[model samples]
Target: MNRKKSLQIFIQSPDLHQIRHESVTGDQTLADLKRSLFPESNHRSSFYFTLHGKPLPDDTPLSIPQIAPLSTLVLQSRLRGGGGDGGATGAESRDCYLKMYSEKKPDKVDPNEQRLSKWQNCALSNEPLREPCVIDKLGNIFNKEALVEALLGKKLPKEFGYIKGLKDMITIRLSSVPRAEDGAKFQCPISGLELNGKYRFFALRNCGHVLSAKALKEVRSSSCLVCHEDYGEEDKVVINGNEDEVAALRERMEMEKTRVREGKKNKKVKGESLEGSRLSGTKHVMAAVEKASAKVEVNGKVSNGGGAAKRFKAIDVAPAHATKEVYASIFTSSRKSDFKETYSCRSLPLGRN
Candidate 1:
């Protein structure tokens, strides 16, 4: 034990999530730390120390930059996996020794601790959160690739039906916690508070910058504090919100989609109406011109001093706004032909009679 430099150790063997504190010198080795956690055990070499989910070399000195003071270090056993064991213990000894030990089965990993370990994993696939991550209105994060695969495979759950397409969600850029020592995973850039569900956090849709709600309210600015990007009230989304908070967000999402659909329908109706009016106007102008050009005879008198009075037939064009079924019938063989298909030499073809 040394008083000069101190570090925090989190061993997860007997009791999970239980942090054990032990002071060590800069020149001390990892083996020494393992012995402190299990002093009575002669199987000290059977365990190892891990930092940031990576196992350190047995001879690694604690003076390195990565081993920051008060930073957490996890203790893991060297044994890997097990299966095919009997009910109580594997007395055959042909099976792995881990199964043969009745009293010393591998400690069960706490469910909450498992979730904390997978903090950066995708909510849908439970895989590592990769680039192109998407956040729904309820603030649940998911991998875009995993979502696409699920959609294509037709295996998406009914509860996730709210995510109709990419339009329902927004992409967010998360900022990792800078301090490696703390148990927090993500952090608020402005307040520098841990974003481990303890405090309220919001990610701006305009800039994807995540900041604590306290910071945004204190400054009272319309732009993101981190990137200074301008944003509207609709762009702000709560991260990992409570039940009531998420319900409000879901209602807002539905309203926005409804407004957009209404706008599109209105545009289509306006366009169709304009085209219909133009076609009808053209037909009326044609009828007026036919009357103006035609001459008529009255009481054996020449009209408009013309050499001969004349009559003109009205144009026989079909209406432009016919339905598909009527339009198709216009080209059938039963319809009257305006001009006959005269044969050149009174024969249909060489093979015809």
Candidate 2:
């Protein structure tokens, strides 16, 4: 039986700036080993591993004769513009001169370039070159796919519950450019790995700032990074929102409208009730006034001093025959001709003759 063996390898870049130690089995391929060490370098076509200044074929197994345990490997990108003898062509040498000249030219570089570079990174995670990007109103860009996942209840690094809806988000389109003859690509402001749709992205509804969904999960507050707008769970919306999400947003809006309408209706009802109470109070006041006026007319005259008291005493002492005679004398005509005319008219009225 062949025993499985593991070897620890020290991997470094050509500039020796980044070094990582990884343990690999004898059966593992060099490509797999490189992927484990530097995930971002996988897209390069001409990158290779070197042991003691010698290139190793990608298919060479770790158990090869030239490689041993604890071996040191350097990963390097191939130089472009080589001649038949592997020497630099005249045109290539001139190109190098031109590149050197451009680097030394201070006028070509902008002073605010560093600040601008920071803007290209994900504001939440500070990771550069996140794709499927969305910008908020304030021009901050974030990864949209990660944000959608977060909205769907996936765990995220930053808490971006502040975005209210997807209507406030817009997706950003990135253009790619070739970097070298090895087909290496360069994208401004983003130096991270290619967006493989594995990670999710999000944007702030108010500010349009974009970030990774993972980074948004780490947010501790509801404030936007760029615009500083306060947001809630409803404020963090999905970018390029699907129909169901849009419908849900519309439904939420409708619910809010209904609540507002109900509030107004309740206010109107309360106002009308108050008005009714006021009108009822006014009616009661008017009725009391009328009652007081009638009482004054009937009883106030009697209650006043001696004249009214004297009159009342006379009426009480007077006989009923005298009272009737006084009323008849005042109402009946005194003239004889007038009495005769009234009697004749009454006598003829009974038979329509």
Error of 1 at 178 (Å): 2.9
lDDT of 1 at 160: 83
TM-score of each: 0.52, 0.29
Q: What RMSD does each model have against the real structure?
A: 16.1, 23.1
**lDDT of every predicted structure (CA atoms):** 0.68, 0.54
- Residue 241, candidate 2: Cα error in Å is 2.5
Quality of model 1 by C-alpha lDDT = 0.68
Highest TM-score against the true fold, candidate: 1
Superposition TM-score, candidate 1 onto the true structure: 0.52
Error of 1 at 118 (Å): 7.9
lDDT tens digits by residue: candidate 1, 155-221: 7778788777777667877777765564766778778886566678888987777789999998899
Candidate 1 C-alpha error for residue 102, in Å:
24
